[model samples]
Target: MPLLDVKNLSVNFNTLEGTVRAVQGVSFSLKKREIIGIVGESGCGKSVTVRSILRLIPMPPGEISEGRIMFNGENLLALDQKRLRGIRGSNISMIFQEPMTSLNPVFTIGNQISETFKVHQKMNKQRARKATINILEKVSIPSPEKRFEEYPHQLSGGMRQRVMIAIALACQPKLLIADEPTTALDMTVQAQILDLMLQLSDQFDTSILLITHDLGIVAQTASKVIVMYAGKIIETGSVSSIFKHPFHPYTIGLIKSLPRMGLRSQYGKKPLHEIPGIVPSMNENISGCWFAPRCDQSMDICRKVAPLQKYIDSDHSVSCWLFN
Candidate 1:
């Protein structure tokens, strides 16, 4: 069975202005030790969808309008806070985008990491400390003993991120959600972090839901890819298929926007490709395809009727009138 399955998930936020539909009928699955990447622009619901899986979205405004989030045969959406708390960190851990903010400044690295062990594993302080150091070493943080006593502010961005990973993997959870885990790091550090994640995931036999805006990183790391636009999935397929033959106009535009190896702009000889137009507001009630406004190849039908998901092959699917 797939380790994680999210079906027909719709998320909305009730605001003073109006209700904003952030995620609409998003569905996907991930298997053991597999990595799937979700890619899109800033407000495309990549983070919101994953956050919903963990029940991290605040309830005052945000709500799961409809959906089933099944993890290991259990409906996560139905679980109460107590059971969900038990599952979180122990069964499914998440590494947020920014470690500087994620990690508490007052607590030492040792205290922060050992807290995970104490909370989930119920280990004594001595044992938790030992385990924290071991995990620190495993994540390749130098001088584990000395670093354990240091604060989050003392570590470099890469080292701080490693600490976050160590904490998330402390219990060797079955699934790990990495939301833009390498966003602000240098290219070298980013590669190292990605490699470390893959290595550790293999060791732990964990499935990963890697959410990022970088298509290049997804190309190198994920086996499958899901493309989101205007709060809905526009295309999904194996990495090879999505990168090589993108069917959705938005997906194709995203791939084209990546800087090529030898491509350069000298006197406008080879300008970089960019998708035009901003994403529509969530409050706007889009009657048809949300991407129709910005799509250069949009047909009359695209603006009048929302297209259904169509499959080119078992592993590839797209939602576009062109495919119909």
Candidate 2:
């Protein structure tokens, strides 16, 4: 059975204007020790879809209209808040996108990491503190002994991020959700963080749900890929399939948007060929395909009817008029 499965998940935000549908019928599954990457432009529901699995979206203003996040055959959506909390760090842990903001500035790193152990395992302070230091060392945080007591402000950006990882790993959860974990770090540190995550995955045999906008990073790490656009999944497949044969027009455009090694000179070393239009507001009721206005290959059907996800091969599927 798949370790993690999210089916037909839809999320909406009750804004002052109206309900903003953030995630529209997103679905996928992950197997044991497998790494699935959700890649897309910023605000494409990459984070929302993953966050929904954890039920982190604030209520009153945000809610899951329809969905089921099945982990180990249990539908997480049906679980009450208390049961969900128990499952969050014990069965599923998430490494947030920005550590600087995510971490508590006033609390010492050791205190924060130890809290996870205390909450889940009911470990005493001394034992939890010892566990915290050990986890910090495991994540390759330098001076783990001394840095444990340091506040989030004392550490470098990369170190702070590693501490975040350490906290997430402290519980030894079955699945890890990393949402743009390395987005704020420099190139050198980004490599280190990615390597650390891969190593940890191997060590723990943990399934990972990685949410990011970087295709290059996705190419390096993801075994399977799901591309999101304007609150909907545009395409999905194995890494090899998605890279070599992108069936969706949006996926093709994203590939073209990447900076190629040999095309730099021809492109005058300028910025990339960005997708022309901004994502349409959720308040706007898109008549047909959300990407129709931006797609170069748009046809009458593209403007008149929203396309459904059509299978191209055994593993790959795309939502675009070109396929049908």
Candidate 3:
């Protein structure tokens, strides 16, 4: 059975302007020990979709309008806060985008990490501290014993991120949601972090819901790729299929935008390809495809009718008028 299944999930926000549909009918599934990468440009609802799964979106401004998040056959959307808390951290953990902002500045790294063991596993201070140090060592934080007393601000960006990973994996969670876990780090550090995650995934047998804007990272790490655009999933398939035979225009544009190695223009510089036009505002009500305005191959039908998702093969699916 799949570890997580998000079925027709729609998330909306009430703003001063109007009701903004941030995620519309987004659906996907993840199997045990499988890594699925959700890729898209900024503000494409990738974060909102995952945040909704954990019921993290504040209710006053945000609402999960429709759909179910089925994790291990239990409907996460139906779980109450108290029940949900029991599952979070112990069963499912998250590594946030920014470590500095995510970690409490005033608290020592060990104290913050130990709190998870205390709350979720009911461990005493002595045991929690021991476990925290062990986890820090597991994440390759140098001088873990000494670093335990240090605050978030005292550590470098890469070390802080490793600390965050340590906290998330403290309870050996079965599922890990990484929302751009490698963003803003140097390339070498990025590779180290990715390698660490893959090794830990094997160690703990964890399924990963990896969210990122970098297609290269997805190409290297994920088994499957989900392309999100304008608050919806435009294409999904195996990584090999998505990279080599993309069907959706948006997916094609994204693949073409990646900088190729050893490629140069006559002027000794290679120009990168960029998709034209900006993503449509969520507040706007578009009757047809939201990407039509930006899509080079958009037709009259694409502008007039929204295309249903069509299957190219058993595993590859795309939503586009060209297939319709």
Candidate 4:
């Protein structure tokens, strides 16, 4: 069985304006020790989907309106708070996008990291502190002993991010959800962080769900890719297949938007390609295909009837009227 299976998951938010259907029928599977990338624009629900897997969404405003999240033969959606807590840090861990906000300002780095070990591994305070220092060193944090007493605000962005990674890896979880882990870092630091994550994944045999808007990062790290638009997955395939032969118009647009190494000189200062039009708001009741309004190849059917995912080959699938 796959390490994680998200089936027909839908997430909604109740706001003053209206109910926002943020995630719509999103489904994917992550195999053992494989890295899967979820890529899309800002409001495409990539973060929401991953947060839902961990039951992190606040119920008063947000809800898992439909579907199941199965991890290791257990349905996370069906689990109680106590049961879910048991699985959260020990079995599945998440590295959120922003470290400053995610980390507690009042707690020392060692306290926070050691808390994971204390709660999940049942380690004593001293043992947990030792383990926390070990994790800090593993993530290549210099002067782990000194940094242990530092608060989140005291560190640089890169260093703060490394501390977050250390906490996430404290328990050696089977699955790791990294949501834009390299955001706001310099190119060099970003590369280093990615390399560290790859090394850790190899050492721990961890299955990673990497959520990011950068296709370049996806190309570098993921084996399979899921392209989401307007809270729905539009295309999915092996990384090479999606990169080389994108079948959906939305996927094609996204790939084209990337600045190629040689294409810049060929264009001679021409503007980079952009996917025209903005992503539709979740509160807007979009009929038929959500991408139809922006799709160049959209037809009458695309505006009237939503297309189901159509398999092109053993590994590639696209949701579009053209495929139908």
- The models' CA-based lDDT, in order, is 0.94, 0.89, 0.93, 0.92
* lDDT (Cα, 0-100) at 254 in candidate 1: 84
C-alpha lDDT of residue 286 in model 1: 84
Span of 10 residues, lowest total lDDT, candidate 2: 264-273
Query: How high is the lDDT of residue 138 in model 4?
Result: 98
lDDT of 2 at 128: 93
Alpha-carbon RMSD, each predicted model: 1.5, 1.7, 1.4, 1.1
Off by over 4 Å in 1: 265-268
Q: What is the lDDT of residue 58 in candidate 4?
A: 90
Candidate 2 stretches with Cα past 4 Å from truth are 265-274
Stretches of model 3 off by over 4 angstroms after superposition: 265-270
User: Worst ten-residue run, lDDT, model 1?
Assistant: 262-271
Instruction: Name the candidate, 2 or 4, with the larger lDDT value.
Output: 4
lDDT of 3 by residue, 1-324 (tens): 889999999999999999999999999999999999999998899999999989888997999999999999999999999999998888999999888899999899999999999999999999999999999999999899999999999999899999888988888888999999999688999999999998998899999999999999999999999999999999999999999999999999888888877666444776678899788899999988999999999899988888899999999999999997
Q: Spell out the clash pairs found in candidate 3.
A: none
Candidate 4 regions off by >4 Å? none
Report backbone clashes per prediction: 0, 0, 0, 0
TM-score of each: 0.97, 0.95, 0.97, 0.97
* Candidate 4 lDDT over residue span 11-73, tens digit each: 999999999999999999999999999999999999999999998989979999899988999
Q: Write candidate 1's Cα lDDT for 194-300 as tens digits.
A: 99999999999989999999998999999999999988999999999999999999998988888776555434356678889889999999888999999999898
